[model samples]
Target: MPKLIKDGRVVDDQWQGEILQPEQIPESPAAPVAVQLEPGQGPATIPCALSNLGLVTIFFPAFTDGRCFSYARELRESGYTGEIRATGHFIRDQLFYLQRCGFNAFQFAEEVDLDACLASLSDFSESYQAAVDQPEPLFLRR
Candidate 1:
C-alpha cells in the first residue's frame, strides 16, 4: 500500500474512482473517491456529482495544464465540503499552491520524500492572498 502524509502524519492511502456516468458511484461508505477529467471538460458538469459522492480526488493528467486547479477552487466555492485531492504528475513544489486551491490531499506519480514535501507545506510563514482553504485570504492577516 502506498503511504500519504496527511495532516502531518503518514498513513495508508485509499481512494475510489467516480466514473463519468452518474450511476457509477454507489451510496455505500467507501474509500475517498477520485474523479478524472479529460481535457476541456467543464467543472460545472461534474462537481455536484463528485460532492455528493463524498471524498473526491481530481486528476491533472499533466502538471502544466492547470484547469483542474480552477476546478478545485470552484468546487469549494460552490459548497462541496468533502476532501479534495490532487493526483498525477504533481510536484512537491505544487503542494502549498494546491492546498491554497483547496486540495487537502495529493497522490504524486512516484515515491517522494514525504517528510520534505510535508515540510514544504509551510515553507513560507505568510501568503499574500486568501485561497479556498484559507478563508481569511492572506491579505487580511495582521
Candidate 2:
C-alpha cells in the first residue's frame, strides 16, 4: 500500500475508487468510481453519481493547470462530503491551498518527496484567508 498525505499526516492510502476516464464515464458503473474533473466542466455537467461517490480524486494534468482547486471547493459546497484526493504534478507549495479547497488527501506525482510534502502542511501556523480547515480569516477574529 502506497502512502499518501492525508489530513497532514502520511498514511497508508486505501483508495478504492476506480480511475474512470472521460470517454468511459457515460456507462453506468457497478462499483465506486473516482473521476477526474478537468478545467472547464460545470458542476451540472458532472454525473449525479459522481456527487454520491465516496472518494473523489482531483486530477492536476500539469503543474500550471489550477482548475482542480475550484473543483474541490465546488464539490464541498455541492455537499459531496467524501474524501477528496489531489493527484498528479502539483507543486508542494499548493498543499495548503489544496486543503483549503477541500482536498483531504494528496497523491503527488512519483517524483515528489512525500516527507517534505508532509512537512509543508505545517509550515505556517496561520493563514489570513478563509479556507476549508479554517473557515474564518484572521482579520475577522481580531
Candidate 3:
C-alpha cells in the first residue's frame, strides 16, 4: 500500500479502487485525469484538455525538475479547482511551498517520521505575504 502524508502524519491511503501502482495512476474516471509532464515537454493543448477533466496529478519525475512546479502554479492560476498532487522524489521540505502553488497532497517515496517532518511545515515563526491557503499569510495577523 502507498503512504500518504496528511496533517504531518504518515498514514495508509484509503482511497477505494485499485491502488495506484508504482508509476501508475489510472485515467481520471472523475473527469479530468492526472497528467504527467516530462522535461522539455512544452506546455500546449494537453494541460488545457486535462484541465477540463477534473482531478489532475502533475508529476515531478524528480525533485530537481522545476518545470512541473511552474506547470502546477500555472494550472491553478488558469482556474483548475481540482486536486493537484505531487508525486515522485518529493520531500516534506517542499510541502508548504507546493501547497501554496496548489498541490494539496503529497505521495512521498518512503515512510517518513511524520511528527518530525510536520514540524517543518511551519519552520518560520511568521510570513509577510498571503498564500493560496492562508489569506493573511502569517506576519500580517492582528
Cα error, residue 42 of model 2, in Å, equals: 5.2
TM-score of each candidate structure, all chains considered together: 0.78, 0.82, 0.64
Q: Pick the candidate with the highest lDDT.
A: 2
Q: Could you give candidate 2's per-residue lDDT for residues 8-123 as a string of tens digits?
A: 78898887557655455665666666666666753455564664465777778886887888888888877777788888888898887788889999988766778878877766
Model 3, span 1-142: residue lDDT tens: 7776654466776444432322343333444344554446523435244444444455666878777777777767767766666677777788777776667666766677756776666666555776555657556685
In candidate 3, stretches whose alpha carbon ends up further than 4 angstroms from where it belongs are: 6-32, 42-51, 129-131, 134-142
| lDDT, candidates in the order shown | 0.68, 0.76, 0.60
Q: Evaluate model 1: give its lDDT.
A: 0.68
Worst 10 residues of 1 by lDDT: 16-25
Best-to-worst ranking by lDDT: 2, 1, 3
Clashing residue pair totals per candidate (backbone < 3 A): 3, 0, 3
Over the stretch 1-142, how does candidate 1's per-residue lDDT look in tens digits? 8877565555678653444432343554354344454347645555344545555567778888788888788878878777676767778888878888887877677888887789777767777787886678655777
Clashes in model 1: which pairs? 129-138, 130-137, 130-138
- The predicted structure with the larger TM-score, 1 or 3, is 1
Lowest-sum lDDT 10-residue window in model 2: 42-51
Better of 2 and 3 by lDDT: 2
List ranges where model 2 is wrong by over 4 Å.
Answer: 22-32, 49-51
